[model samples]
Target: MPENIVIIGTSGAIGSAFTRRMSALHPASKIHAFSQSSTPTSEGNITYHPICYADEASIQDAASLAAETGPLDTVIVATGLLHEGDIRPEKSLKDLSAKKFMKIFEANTITPSLLAKHFIPKLNRDNKATFAAISARVGSISDNRLGGWYAYRASKAALNMILKNAALETARRNKNAVIIGLHPGTVDTDLSKPFQANVPSGKLFTPDFAATKMLKVLDSLSPQHSGKIFAWDGQEISP
Candidate 1:
């Protein structure tokens, strides 16, 4: 069992839901809930840590704190950037800007990789362990059709490459470690709230529902599944 499970971006809908689910399933496990925007809350079996992935020092400090709790078996990077004040995804090349591109890449691409750098050493090599980051289905280049949201799609695609490379290196050192990307589908969260109006009936998932689906996938993952991206229903998405 995972004695230490860390969920970064615990302030977000999916992150918080994942934290609660982990706490419920493995009550004895330590759940490290790290978020930059969330205030610390008292949740049994869950410890909160203030973290900002933009700063390497913050992540290192948080990693150090989690290490004190013991070996980490599961680490989830649920942080993502879809939109922010004055910055929305470009619908066309004319709307794309260098600043917006960098911002999306910073959060979607760099953060998960940075987390892996700090937390990979803490993974349980003696047992099956997983490190997952929330990636988007649009990141799949072959799956692309609509072709909007250029920056968001490209950043996620970049994130997938990083995870794939990390998974390969991780397997060389820890044969039992699974480092993979997850696509949570169109969850009904603030990240998707702005663009969810046209979503088909019964397609938009609740945070809890999405979290459960992802946990099920994580539960079944093996080291052999590393370097791949799985969707909410456990099906693989081609990169």
Candidate 2:
């Protein structure tokens, strides 16, 4: 079992669930939870820290602090952005804009990349370790049947490629390291709130349900599973 864990973006619905579920499942593990804004009051085996996704120094500092006790066993980046304030998914080519694309990519792609950059090196070298970022099934080019959400889709696709690259590079240093993406389906969270009306019955999962399933998937993966995307049901998503 993992002895040390780090979870980024624990302020969000899914991220907070991950923090809680992971703590329950691994009671002996030390969980270092980081949030972009609100600092959760530390309790039991879990401790909270403040982080800024837009700043690399903040990420680096958080990583250093988390790994100060020992090399990390698991690092889960549970952050994502679908829509906020004035930004929403594009429905067609005419809806795309440079500003929207940059904002989406910065949140969906760049922040996770920086997390991996700073945290991957903190992974335990002598044992199995996992680094996962929450991605979307729409990011799968082969799985895309609808042609909307260009910026979000492209950003996640780019994030997938970065994971693949990180997997390959990390394998060279630690053969047991696993780096991959996860698709949590249509979770009942703010991120999916706007598009839930079209979702089929029983397709919308609670944050706790998604968290449980994903933790199971993470537990079942091995080194060979690195560089791939897995859904909450443990099915591999084709790129």
Candidate 3:
């Protein structure tokens, strides 16, 4: 059967790239793209929906509508918020604030959790299914040796926990559903623009390149790999 894929945060760099990648990889797959901003017009097998990640009603509506087309085999939460107009990651303890911390948690942790809540029901139980969130390597508590961006790191860590919990629950009901957290590495997207100065040549990946690596990793997961965080190259990251 042809795949049915749902991509939340489709207006972002990585999300848009995944949209294109999926369309190219599976011409017959139904790709339902959602974003907080106005997405481009639907064309070919791709359909666009406006969504607010903070609003449960919008997410539920989008998932409900997307489910009408076909059973969902894959759902990717590509939403991320490294910084806004004034909300950048804290460099030290003095830079921390409750509001900024909450904002980070809202985007990194809550968004993907809510996506699973509404869309996991549509996952294919009788066959393979995937639920993946675009997480950062900084999210790994065991791997954090530099330690500076407190809020961003903590929120992603929380997101990792959420992914693990979701994976365990999904396995209890549907052994084939692989819920995971993914690190796209240092991709050349708006999210990484301000920080890309330090990235060495050949290290910064384009959105398309990152998306391709992620697709291959997602395709290779099995029941044993659920509840884990993985890098772009397919190695598992420590929690």
Candidate 4:
């Protein structure tokens, strides 16, 4: 089990669920949870920290603070963007715009890249370590049968490439380190709420279920698994 864990985007449903599950499962571990919201009163093994995901300086500061405790064994970036006010997934080529693409890419691609830049160096070299970002199966170019969500899909695809790059670079420093992308499988969160109607029966996962399954998958990973994307059922997705 990881002794020192860092979770970015802790204010999200899945992120918060991961924090709760990790704390319960590994009581002796120290979890540094970062989010955009102000730090809350910490309890047990979890400590909350505020962060601005759009700013590199804020990301670096959080990494520094988390590293002060010890070398990080795990860094999970749970940040992503799908829809917000005035911003929704594109339904057709006509809906595409530079503004939408930039906003989506900033949240899905750039944020994870910045996190890896600041946190990957802090991973423990002596033991197995993992850096994971939440990605989606729709990001898989080969699996994309319906290509409607242009920006979201492209952003995740780029994010997957970033994971591959980070994994290769980190290998030269720490051979035991693994950087991967995780597909949480349509969790019932605010990000997916508007699109949940089309989801098949029993396909929607609760935040807790997604968190537990992801932790199980993470526990099963090794350096050889780096640069790949894995689903909640532990199956690899083609990039």
Alpha-carbon error at 149 in model 4, in Å? Answer: 0.3
What TM-score, computed on C-alpha atoms, does each candidate reach? 0.97, 0.98, 0.97, 0.98
Error of 4 at 194 (Å): 0.8
State which candidate, 1 or 2, has the greater TM-score.
Answer: 2
Model 1, residue 77: distance off in Å is: 0.6
Write down the lDDT that model 3 would get: 0.89
Better of 2 and 3 by lDDT: 2
Candidates' lDDT values, in order?
0.92, 0.95, 0.89, 0.94
Off by over 4 Å in 3: none
Q: Write the per-residue lDDT of candidate 4 for residues 20-54, one digit (tens) a residue.
A: 99999999999999999957657889999899987
Which residue ranges in model 2 land beyond 4 Å of their true spot? none
By TM-score, how accurate is candidate 4?
0.98
TM-score, model 2 to reference: 0.98
After superposition of all CA atoms, the RMSD between model 1 and the true structure is 1.0
Give one digit per residue, the lDDT tens place, for model 1 in 1-239.
Answer: 88889999998999999999999999999899999985666579998878978899899888888889777899999999999998898888899999999999999998888998998878888999889999999999999999989989999999999999999998988998999999999999999999899899999999999999999999999999999999999999999
Deviation (Å) of 162 in candidate 1: 0.4
Residue-pair clashes per candidate: 0, 0, 0, 0
Positional deviation of 27 in candidate 2, in angstroms? Answer: 1.2
Between prediction 1 and prediction 3, the one with superior TM-score is 1
